[model samples]
Target: MRKFPFLLTVATIPAAIPAAATAQPVQSLDQVEETVLADDADDADDADATGEVEAITVTATGLFTRIENTGQAVTVIGRDEIEAVQGADITRVLARAPGVAFSRNGPPGAFTGVRVRGGEAEQLLVLIDGVRVADPASPSGGFDFGTLTTGTVGKIDLLRGSNSTIWGSDAIAGVLDISTRGRSGLAGSVEYGARDTLFASATGGLSEDAYFAGLAASFFRTDGFSSAAAGTEADGSEQFTLGGSVFVDLTDQLELFANTRYANSDIDIDGFPAPSYTLGDTSETQETEQLSGALGLAYYGQDLTLRASYALADTARDNFDPALGAAPLFTSDGNSQNLSLRGEYRLIGGLTLAFGGNREWSEYQTDSDTGEDATITGAYVQAGWVLGGLAAHVGARVDDHDRFGSATSFGGDVSYRVGGGWRLRASVGEGFKAPTLYQLYSPYGNLDLQPEQSTSADFGVEHGVRGSDFHAALTLFRRDSENLIGFDNATFTYANIARARAQGIEAELGVDLAPSLRLAGVYSLVDTENRETDNELARRPRHSATLFADWQTPLGLVIGGDLRLVGDSFDNAANTVRLEGYEVFDLRASYPFGDGVELFGRVENVFDEEYQTAAGYGSPGRGAFLGVRAQM
Candidate 1:
């Protein structure tokens, strides 16, 4: 489960920045270059705090590596680890990453889903700014992250495996690129907590030479948590958002950009715990709205940098009331539009070349008894290479679906440095996913479903340590999937006899030990199978790990702790109930009084660990929260 909405998209080059760099500042969501440059492109050392992480301009990978040379397995969660972990959502920040596995149907924005390495979840491929929003009409095509809301995020990049060449189709178990935050100056913040939590946001920026603008807004609410069955509690939501961006400076070459967004969410679905929470019929009331827009144009001479973009998204869902009496009361709508063109060239010395093409159109509608309607189109191309430190990449794609007739894929990756800071990587990929529209015309579904394919490979190694400023990485992965469509409990629909195979390994480490004391950890191991009903693929858990430590003492306070563990899987998949494995603990502390206001507190699942990765659902046990943030 990955949900990012923090904002970022900076395009700079005019006047080469005040003299020779040194004007690119403005990053402090707790550094690390906002978690490894939008989902694993790695390496961007400290940079003395801010200046916007030295001109940060990562819209999520395009065959670029710096996180010590991107050796695959990536993870980055900033904003001070999401404000010292307290009711931290986004699947608890990807459970502190590593192999990754998430599932939640309740508590803090329920109905969440994520699975990597062990694949599943529409074989992963999520992006917000660089396009691709999944759910072309979920029949298992993925993208739900519980309807997203990380409170106008500012950072989150988790890239684990696969990556269909240069992003095309569901990247088969990998690819999560979400970037936001590029409206220049004017900061803002506000907060309130505990069950009825509240949040506020603001951003600003404006440049001249032709024109540049930026703006952002946010509002949120929650009234949930506390329910162990019986009458039920946890079920409340509210949200509102606005975004903007405009750029035009067609001089030295040519440049133009525009973007807009609006979002709304209001949900009150006290619907859970079947067998009658208050009276069997699960309550429901929802309203979901979204409007998206984008336009782009870029052209730079000398070394080349050509671009074009067009994007549009419209989504709506309204269901005033429904308690499952007759089990039907609906309204659904979806729309998607995209067009792309890109070119980047610098072939001579260091080498750099890129290409792009994309086209998409989608639609969905509903009246009641479950509805359907469809259309789709696609195209792709990509390439990259560099000298000196050595790097290489390739891509390919083809998609045409009226009912799942066309599909094609290609992949590649390579990196090397092998010197002191170390670096070595290898990646192979192939991805494809089509056949949605509720699995081709839902009537009882199954219009001879098909289209679900994947192939993957990974190899990694990374290291950095010069006089004690540590960093590390290690990864190994494999995946194979085919067809995969489920339904066989009398729901009457489809069956492709399923097929899955997964293998995984991920490890990470971090350290700073001095300045104020810091340490980090992540680990994961998995093995999943389903070779056609042989069992073992459900909630997937073979092992998981996460550890953390932070300290900064000299009065101003700032302490932390974090730990997580998971093991034991199989909630269903004919494996006959077997979900046990858990370990959670979190703690935080903050104290500052130099104005800008800051008094934080947190304690989550401290020692209270019940277990269940979704067998009967129902999570959030042992909790605590406290908050305060103001910068006026």
Candidate 2:
């Protein structure tokens, strides 16, 4: 179910641009409300002409823009692919994309970090329903993918490379945009699998000519495997999440909306026990709760579009050790209050102006230290031109931090149709990641730390016919970073002393073998170096690839399978410990009955492979699961 990516060239715009990307007010209520998801039906003017639904994407440059209108390397995964995996982990879905790598500390619910284009995990900016969800309490301020289960999420969009000019800070690596179900429908799924695993999720929404509302919830629990490679005790994990969105049209040209999400998780963790001082089972546990929401209003005018939002993200965590008593060994709390304002104005002669401003105040407190806070104010503006046979955009941003002063960034991209069905794309961008509150004010923190900075460039070409199901793209990218933050063993503190470079090739293609069969493949070749020590960065495989195939039978049965290949990589910064590469295969199938219900099942790790992306961590073995899904 790959979306068959396309690289639109400037030559394709001899005609006018799509209204969905313009400032004109839209008439379709669903189109207006679904903007919460970063995409809308009015996406472009080509949808009606082609009679095929057009997939859209949002940009930091301006209002929600059409995918074909941008030059960034972007990947889109819809609900169909999520269900095809039939798994609860989101990292599994993300691994299928190019230029992406991840390392999990242990099993599900453990800490997981995703790295893009040689950039550290903490450099990526993640947005859920437009809320920046990174945990400021973390040492590096990175989101844990292991805690992100595939629940009511209906769409995922990944932008690879630096986009700081588009989103301010925290975009040195890239950006991951996730959206929950936004369409009008009733859907649910229940599954029971190995290790006493249970997963259940439900989503429902109602949409009218003037309003749209939706709710979704999911629960997951597993009597998991031992996290320690040498331990025999089983660690368990449990999680619950609930989210909802509401949109009401105040007028034909104005809309009001609210979005919120809540999650709670408890996980049993293994620790390095005394005496042996090695990873082993211990009486340790962690409990965490997260709440994020936003209230906003959007105005759609004949020549200008404006949006305003007030959002907050709050997280609290507690860790307990039996040896230290049941009162809890440690605790921490983090919160971010944000104000966002953005607009896009369409001018005459195929010119558009995109601008945005943001203000954020973040605070973090732990039992070990007093609470600390910081504020950041930023603004950016970009102009796009759709001339007869050329398309391009250039933007600049300025961000000022209460403690760290100011930093400025600039970026631009272009696309041109060279003729035939081929298009050429190229982009150069600058990005930066500010030091987290914990990094600056903690007991081991360093006030002298500066923001990590990066400069990235990518060039590629793609070939695909608009009406055809066949598509292919190849890109070459490189990124050089400075002032990267890392723990200094000698100083026993965090410092900005690392310099690095990451360069690689990404190739992807999708096609239909038959009317009922589809195949897709993505391959990445990444080369990374620490520069300081001349060693490859840990846990990033030099080569990786994924293959996907799906078949639809005449009897209405849908069968799908995917294979993953990873090359060897080091598990430690000094390259003293090696982690062998491994292969894992998975298969899933679903059959529709009547009454909007379907039965499905899946097998994971068909070969029961033994391998680890992180040393001393255990990987999942063969497992099976069965489930039923309902749609109404």
Candidate 3:
């Protein structure tokens, strides 16, 4: 990959990303439900240092519009919710949301990808601490969920549809914006579970009158899982991460902030030996290292919020084969650097404007010196209006890629409050993403690969207005995509030869039966098809549902359980391999004892239901974990 003075190209920056709504601490499942239904106020970082659960607000919007004001399908997972669903893997936690499906090659630490509304992983844009972390070295330039642990994350905002006007390229399917721990004082956890797995994490933060700083670290290791269906060897894995964030007030209305995170992982992989092109356990392993960080300044005025930032993401990978000596058989390195300036300002009565410009440089290189670099400059603007009981927002973006020329995207959404606890909303968004460097220049590269473009729209209705304890919503969504990029294994090359459509309905209901009890349920019916082949998209279930409930007993014992139900799916694009469906149930319990400490345990796959998400790869059956977590 070319090493150039990318930072010096700040002049290339255009109007780009703006701040989303900040998250407020949620204290219970009821509050979590309320957050999804409430969307009216701006807390500016939820300004409440009391650390109490406040009205759930969807604050990730540039103008801090409430959920009721936005037409897009969104789910916000906060720290309390994250802790409630205790798991090292981020994918498992995300599965609780509707229209979310994931596939893992074998056990944990394997190649994991998540598809939203039946959209491919590469179409999702992931941001960690405001830094885009997609691996440029990967053929799809996507972020892998396999190595990301939930410990360091404080919040997750999932927007389930295209909105490239705000996120720029790669926002075809959805956007996952994650923030690291911003909690005050000390907090962390330690746990031991199935497969002799050990996991631990620590986070510490100090908040002064004018400054706040935090540091976090986590380690995980697991053993005894075979990647190959017919193999007997255990493919172990281990990983660790270190991260920190800082915010300092430079003046009455000016603030400076910075964040950094690093992760390293090693996992045993399977391979097919010579003379046998079949999957089997082998002395093969993979190592990955990643780093992401950002630095920025913000000015907060009475009616204007402006921010400027510089961010960088780097990924390095190596694979080793014992039969080929001790040295790595393959290696790759890639990185992306970005500079941007964005802001939101009140234009007039009930009107606001959000605008930004961004310049990004990305490049990747393999061992064979098959390397390339590209730069993209983009600008975007969004206008929002609040008139009486109606709210609307529209946005447009234009981008110029050094290798793919220029493209334009537009999106619009509206929400209206009807009578009685009812709100109606609709949205339409468009996306345009250029081919990744690896897809265009690698050994199996296809020079003719075209950019992936898509359009997504959704209409929905919801109840849970006026702070009602019971909440329910139904959303209908559809997406049509063209020139989708995929690896052509038959010819051992990459191609833009696929077109697809995904249509689905998502329904969710929640009720706070009482202060001590809460129940939530989500269901999705995704109908997906390959327009070119007339087959259902691989690995996407036509039916998926999840049920969850929690109770706090008089004895101070908290118990909770969740069940996931999935329908059958095809393993290959041709739909020849059938993958059976399965259900998994989990039970969790916790009790407070010492100061700021809680003992927690969970029984996963209680019935030991054996399942396979992929054709030959088996999922973990029954497992259990016990741990302790503390917070001040």
Candidate 4:
């Protein structure tokens, strides 16, 4: 691979180049779902102190949009939800989402990824504060969800289905956009909990209008659970994160904001060789750190709003395997850098248009066998329109790589009111995932693999209860994929299979029940398989459901609990490892003494049932955690 520093000259296309025939066409929308926020008018007491959940904002569409009106299947996890769940990692927070699967190789904050709609881990795109965070050096080209801690997270938006037209490559499955809030004046937390877990966080805002600057930092350490095998117990890790942002009110109509976050984590690893199934003292260790920064300007007026941003990310990793009696010394280093600029505009009468482009440069340098350098450049454009009781959305993207020629993706969706407080929505889209550097340039072989692509269709209907705080919805979806990437069993070489597919239905119901109590239930059923191989997809449960309830009493206490259930599923494409179904429970309680302080505690894995959601792995058993929070 070659560096393209001067390639910018070729990248400049005279500004008048004709659009390619394959250039995607733009579309718009009419009706959108109204968002139901935590700060809704009905809950005056809950909205008084901590600001209602409705006050929370989301950047799900690469632009700021209220959660409910996003015109997509979007789920938001706000600060209250984050704190109540006692979730230490992204996997636990997103586990309730339909068609989403997560697994980890070690303890909390370890190597982990999310699989969507039976797609491989690499097919999902992960973002932090609107910046893409996928690791270019990953063997499978996916973002490692394990690196992010829940301490700094303000909210998370999980958008299901193909989003390639809005995002770009690696969005064949969907997107998980994470947003963290900047520290405000005099706000911080110091907490320690059960299971050897220690955590501390602080955020402070400076200047009036909170427009000058702010800082947030957190540190975490935990001892992990292990299998019965030796060398697998007590293998834990630690992490530290520091983030800062500056917001300048350039003018009344325009604001300039810049922010950056850096995270450093160290993990302890245990590897075992096959045949004996005995643990070896390999003493593997890994250190990872990532830096992300973005600067943007926004202008808003009565009828027009415009915004633009430039973002950059640089990440690196170092992995080491200590020398053993027979095992040779092994070490590897990998890094990647990316730069992107995007723009969005709002036109007359609820019409919005958006466009953006990004260039990414990545490299892997190591003494180990696999090493390479690669470059990828991608661009996209989108438009949305809305009218009374109707909404439409469409977009397209193109990715040109130095190795592969180019790939294009597009999608469109629409929603309409069906009367009687009922709504119907449908969408069709195409998404693509490019081959990673390891798959294309690794010394192990197979440099001729093609990119994977998929087409998806979805339909959903929702209804609201008249004069009551109750709602329900049912969604059906199907996806067809081509050039799916996999490895050959005989030679261990990367290859593209002919096809794969997933069909599923998800239903959700929520009720206020009463002023102090709320209840929600979700059920999901999926049939996912590989068409070419005639086998079940790996690590995808056919049936899953969740029950969650939150209640507050006159005793000044808030309590909540949730249950998650997953049915049996195969572990591999060959259908060899059959994982049994299991259910887990969690509980949380919190209360405030009105002195700007609160005490909170959570019990996870309440049943302590021992089961493996992943093949040949061990998950954390029943655990308890308690912490205190203070605000001023």
- Kindly indicate the candidate among 2 and 3 with the higher lDDT: 2
Query: Deviation in angstroms for 239 in model 4?
Result: 1.6
Query: On residues 88-167, what C-alpha lDDT tens digit does candidate 1 reach at each position?
Result: 36677777778888877555555578987788877788766555666554456577676666555555666766655455
Best by TM-score: 2
Candidate 4 Cα deviation (angstroms), residue 162: 0.9
Mind sharing the TM-score for model 4? Answer: 0.86
Candidate order by decreasing lDDT: 2, 3, 4, 1
Better of 1 and 2 by lDDT: 2
Worst 10 residues of 3 by lDDT: 1-10
Clash pairs for candidate 2: none
- Candidate 3 has a TM-score of 0.90
**What TM-score do all the candidates reach, one by one?**
0.31, 0.93, 0.90, 0.86
Q: What lDDT does candidate 4 reach at residue 120?
A: 75
Lowest lDDT sum, 10 consecutive residues, model 4, at 13-22
Off by over 4 Å in 1: 1-73, 76-84, 91-140, 147-169, 172-193, 196-327, 331-417, 426-428, 442-469, 472-516, 519-549, 552-587, 590-600, 603-632
- Cα lDDT, model 3, residue 591: 92
lDDT of 3 by residue, 185-240 (tens): 78889999999989899988776656667788989999948988778898889989
Worst 10 residues of 2 by lDDT: 4-13
Give candidate 2's error at residue 50 in angstroms. 9.0
